[model samples]
Target chain A: MLQFAAIILLMLGLYGLLTQRNVIKIIISLNILEIGLNLFIISVGYFEGGLAPIFTSETPANPNFVDPLPQALVLTAIVIGVGTTALGLALARKIYQKYGTLNLDEMGEN
Target chain B: MLDNIEVLQVLEIVIAVFMVVLAFLAINSKSLIKAVMFLSALSMLSVIGFVVMQAPDVAVTEAVIGSGLVTSLFVFTLLATKKVGVK
Candidate 1:
């Protein structure tokens, strides 16, 4: 269920990227894309009757823990996503300063 | 009596639908700040969705990092831009 939802979110993000004219809007679309990607990746680790990978005193002889590998990878990916978003926003600010407008059309050959 | 699993399943659907709706709204919003707000809301929903899917670690990280940090970055960028006064 979540897998499909993530896919739909991805498609929406892509649509925004293709159609949006503003630099900020495009960056927002990139964010949407990353969120959807993370969701999809994390959803892969889910399973019925699964608990978090953390272990504590409440152990029941054996336990079904969701895949920790994907979770860890997603943690790293989230940090990277933040870094890239910051970079994009910085570039956007520069674009605005240099071009005096964020609209792609306005920036064209001006 | 609904079992915990059943409730979570329902939650999964609700979060997914809300995520999609919010994503759509975030991108399509007329005002840039409104779009940023929608993106933050979507991030918050993703945190809940992660928790539902048995991902406490990611949920905690997302709750802290995704919504607040990203929104602030966006808002700051908007602040620096000329002719686009915060509205």
Candidate 2:
């Protein structure tokens, strides 16, 4: 079910990226695409009654835990998303400074 | 193995639908600030979805960075552009 939603989000992001004229809106669409991927990965690892994949003396020796690999991977992806977003925004700032406009078609041509 | 699968599945479906709506609105919004706010709201909903999917760690990270940091960064950029004195 969540996978279905993720697919929808991916398409929505693609639509925005293709249709939006503003640079910032394109960035937002890319972020939405990242989030959809993250959600899909997490959902793939989920199981009913799954505990967090943490080990401690207090924790029982045997327990069902959700797959931790996807969580770790998503963490890395989230940080990377932040970095890319900052870079994109910086480029947008530079573009605005150069062209005084954020619209895709209006930048650098005039 | 939840006994009440129907209710939980229905709730998840509803949340997912709302998330799609928020994403659509965020992309379509005219004001950049409002669009960023809707993006934050979408992340918040995803945080809930993560928790419901049994990933609390991801939920925490999403709440902190997605809802908190990203929104602030976008706002800062918007503000920087809006203030003519800065440029």
Model 1 iRMS (Å) reads 0.8
Q: Give the per-residue lDDT digits (tens) of candidate 1, residues A6-91.
A: 89989999999999988888988988998899899889998977889998899667888999888898899899999999999999
- Model 1, stretches more than 4 Å misplaced? B82-87
Question: What residue runs in model 2 are displaced by over 4 Å at the alpha carbon?
Answer: A55-61, A108-110, B1-7, B83-87
Identify the CAPRI category of the predicted complex in candidate 2.
Answer: medium
- As a TM-score, model 1 comes out at 0.95
Residue by residue across B1-87, what tens digits does model 1's lDDT show? Answer: 349889888888998999999999989988888899899999999999788778899988888888889999998898888434342
Model-by-model lDDT, in order?
0.88, 0.86
Clashing pairs in 2: none
Residue B41 shift from truth in candidate 1, angstroms: 0.3
Residue A29's lDDT in candidate 2: 98
Going through the candidates in order, state the TM-score of chain A alone for each one.
0.95, 0.88
Model 1, docking class? high
